[model samples]
Target: MSRIVSLTASVFAIGLFAGSAVAAGDTITIGIPVGLSGANSVVAPSVVQASELAVDEINAKGGILGKKVVLEVADDASGAAGAQKAYDLLIFKKKVDAIVAMETSAARNAGLPIVNRGKIPYIYTSFYEGRSCNPYMYINAWVPEQQVAPIVDYFNKQGAKTFFLIGSDYAFGRGMLAFTKEYIEKNGGKVVGDEYAPMDATDWTAVLAKVKAVNPDAIITSTAGGAPNVTLTKQLRAAGIKALYGNLAVDEGTARSMGADAEGIYIAGSYFTNIDTPANKSFLAAVEKKFGNDLKTPNELSVPQYEAILAYKAAVEKAGTTEAAKVVPALAEVSVEGPRGTIAMSKQRHAPLTMYLGQVKADGSVSIISSFKDVDPGEQCPKLK
Candidate 1:
């Protein structure tokens, strides 16, 4: 919105921009360290837009605590190295009061120490491997517990006895599949193929060949969100291997981008563009009015970003200050009704999400098969609260 304000090349050979109704230093700064490049680039625009809408709405309503909100966005590049660079500039240089990010787990890990060192509250808006603990951080997104069971259980019920697992060679990929494998077996299904590929690798020929070798009843993939999902799905379709397809990381936007390749790939998520609730309907209207044709479909990854921004505002109002020490504690105690529902991150630094099991239709829209309400995040950082 406002052209994303170009980032200076010196910031990582890229310029940085800030959008605030109030003057620079006079507003509440929310640093969004997201994947503007690399694999997550495809979905980053939606997250940024979500943040913009929340900030704009808050400002329109007289701003937060009488100060407008500003966003300082940096490209994490969807990895540790880029995240380290992004975090350094946003925290140490920009001196942002808080961070609300929807980035890969690797990026989150790379940036958390910097966020903590900067003494700022961090709202990790990514659905991830789970159990990532930090005194200054609260997760307003789904974990493996809320995500895994839906797809796996549906396949099991449909008589899928054997499953194949594949993912990117990273913490998120490995961790998600690991949890999925455990859950599959626990539910009386067998994992036939388990493998991984490098996140940046586009060629899945070898991986596909391996997958073909097993010819399992179900093939589940957990790749890096944006590009990997595109490449792997396309390759899977090209390979002509017919098996029950499921993807743990494909969002509504990414799936749509994949076009026909994403068809029939089952997935589970916390938000869909069609969730019928007054709050979600209003949010959708606002998003449409703001973006129109340019709107990147808001899905699970982005919906939380919008809601988390509101939650952050509530935390600040409750804490009486923007200081991380005070605000961090209030983060989990506040609730925001948005794209999903009443989302409160009170369950051990994580939120209990209402999950949906769906399959990608020919139009790239997900058809909800079953819905699980208030699914527990399950044992994530019990020692925190």
Candidate 2:
């Protein structure tokens, strides 16, 4: 673990060179408004840390456009108002060259309108529902349609005829449930029950009892962070109700937090500790070296943030400029080898190319259940024209 954290720290140092070098007296700043506090803090710190690592690596490689990149971070505290304030500082006050991210969709949605109005290119790092197509924003994570589609298909193959849908009562959870419900019903499955819990809610006994009563073949949970997921799984096992469990938002980070309770639980995801690729091997080794075997990275979100910084660097080099107009197209067309495999970007969809799907096993390890396939931006996106 010390080695992994040190590696990330080294990368963060190198990434400082990613912004365009100030022309003698100029400064190139990158605004990052991430969840540094509040309910999502468990996931937020990693995103910020990973982004710093990406910046450090870029700076070490000589930076974008021969200019040094300076990363300026602000705590969104995982709320709408806080995120909006962070963007105001990054754009109007700090005047950064580009913005890297806002971790949650709610925060992004709260701040994106301001970013678009200013025409500052921003990269979003979390997987979200796909109804957005913004010229000024780039999405590096999977969409609901993309991530949830295959999970439903897998359940069908497993003979899961009835499912219970539970999620955080928010846009991301609700949107995921909507798309999943459509897909599952279309495939001849029934949603026996659907429930929503507040994002910060800790007690899930009521929801668990509701699930137990329904006794569906599977449960599709779309909550955020680690607490609810860990609590629910532990209590369910304590109650001895062990139906097949799958999660959309639960990742390795979440799994590790659950300890022995996370054993045997399955999570559909894009990457894991056990991936065999050369880059992934190096990544895992570095992480193990830094955080130790004790800190489990359950989700694939961190490495993607690392790749986005790299992808943005590559785009800046190809375009020969960091202007949004130049860099936007570069970002859309750029592809890079990532821990999860190849990530490609589309002009129409700000999010990068999607590939491969896997499931988290007991003992907090991940196994690939499906190979990479290009996921097209679904028709649900509002027209930009």
Query: What is candidate 2's lDDT per residue for 82-129, written digit by digit as tens?
Result: 888988888897777788773666777888888887787777777776
lDDT of each: 0.87, 0.70
Tens-digit per-residue lDDT, 101-217, candidate 1: 999999999998897788789999888888899998999988999999888888887789999998999999999999999999988999988989988879999988998988899
lDDT measured at residue 321 in model 2 versus the true structure, 0 to 100: 81
Q: Please report, as a residue range, the 10-residue window in candidate 2 with the lowest summed lDDT.
A: 1-10
Off by more than 4 A, model 1: 1-25
Clash pairs detected, candidate 1:
7-14, 7-15, 7-16, 8-14, 8-15, 8-16, 9-13, 9-14
In order of appearance, the predictions have TM-scores of 0.95, 0.87
Question: After superposition, which runs of candidate 2 have C-alpha atoms over 4 Å from their true positions?
Answer: 1-27, 286-298, 350-357, 380-385
Task: Give model 1's TM-score versus the native structure.
Answer: 0.95
Model 2, residue 222: displacement in angstroms? Answer: 0.5
Backbone clashes, each candidate: 8, 29
